[model samples]
Target: MKRPERMARLARAQRALAEVAKAESIAANARYEDSARQADEILDALNATNVLHGFAVKAMADTLRRNGRTTERLRRVADERASQYVRQERTAEVLEERATQASSEARRKEERQRIEILVSSPRRR
Candidate 1:
């Protein structure tokens, strides 16, 4: 080929290569920007999830604490009631014992009076 023709063709090739390089660079930058946006979205979602988990854990702990306190109070009440019942039962037993002793004493007195009356009136034959 002639020198001028060859030179013109080389220039055209160089221009084409530069255009392709510019297009590639633009595409690479767009891809990088999209990837960065997705990463930011993922980070935001993770942060929100962590916050929700923390709140849930705190609420559950509070509920457990309240339940524990309630159970302790109920146990204390039951123990006090049991003690009162035992005291009442002991008092009833003591009263019953006293009543039995009094009844036995009265029966013995009546038997002695009957024997005296029968001995004194022994001339009815």
Candidate 2:
């Protein structure tokens, strides 16, 4: 395939990849939100309780601590995925622009070649 066409195909592939990345980022964000919400609920439960056995209190505190850590990890993962999506999106846009430029350049070159041929050819008269 021609350079311009190949570039265009590559750009399209990049766009697809970017879309996938965006979806993944969104999913990650949702997971992070869910985890955070669960952690908050756990915290609220811990605070609302006035009477609890020693073992139950320890278990709740341990669960809350674990949930907090999981929430933080999920948040970081979501942030990383979002950053990756942005990078992929920018790469797709740049590839599309380059393809357009290549196509334009090819057209201009062909036009110049045609003009040169016309100017050089002898008249049939």
Candidate 3:
């Protein structure tokens, strides 16, 4: 090939490689953003549920107090509410963990794809 022609080809290849790299980076970043959005949604839902639970518990406590309930009954209600709260917390933890795992997997997959593309590209002699 003529010198100018070879240089042009090299430049074209370099541009293509840069474009591909940029696309891959954008895709990976998009995936990360989507995962973060999902996590935020889950957290918001958990917070809303927790707030509702708190409101319900408070209402019940207020009602009991207004009705002149005994200490034993109040204690039992508090215990039950505590147990329920613990269960909800456990569920939130599981959901958060799953979200993190999914994000990690997505990142790994993106890395592998980038590596494969790099390795498969034709190298100039």
Judging by lDDT against the true structure, name the best candidate.
2
lDDT (Cα, 0-100) at 43 in candidate 3? 45
Better of 1 and 2 by TM-score: 2
Clash-forming residue pairs, model 1: none
Q: Write model 1 residue lDDT over 9-121, tens digit each, in one string.
A: 55555555555555555555555555455545544454556546665665555655665565555555555555555555555555455555555666778799999898888
Lowest lDDT sum, 10 consecutive residues, model 2, at: 46-55
**Model 3 score (lDDT):** 0.56
8 Cα displacement, candidate 1 (Å) = 99
Identify the leading candidate in terms of TM-score. 2
- lDDT digits (tens) for residues 22-122 of candidate 2: 99999999999999888888777777756564547778889988988998999999999999999999999999999999999999999999999999999
Q: What's the TM-score of each model vs. the native?
A: 0.50, 0.90, 0.42
Q: How many residue pairs clash in each candidate?
A: 0, 0, 0
- Cα deviation in Å at residue 10, candidate 1? 99
Q: For model 3, how does the per-residue alpha-carbon lDDT over 1-125 read when each residue is reduced to its tens digit?
A: 64444444555555555555555555555555554555455445445655466656655555445434343444455455555555555555555555556667767888999999999999989
A best-first ranking of the candidates according to their lDDT comes to 2, 1, 3
- What lDDT would each prediction earn against the true structure? 0.56, 0.93, 0.56
Q: Is candidate 1 or 3 superior in TM-score?
A: 1
TM-score of 2: 0.90
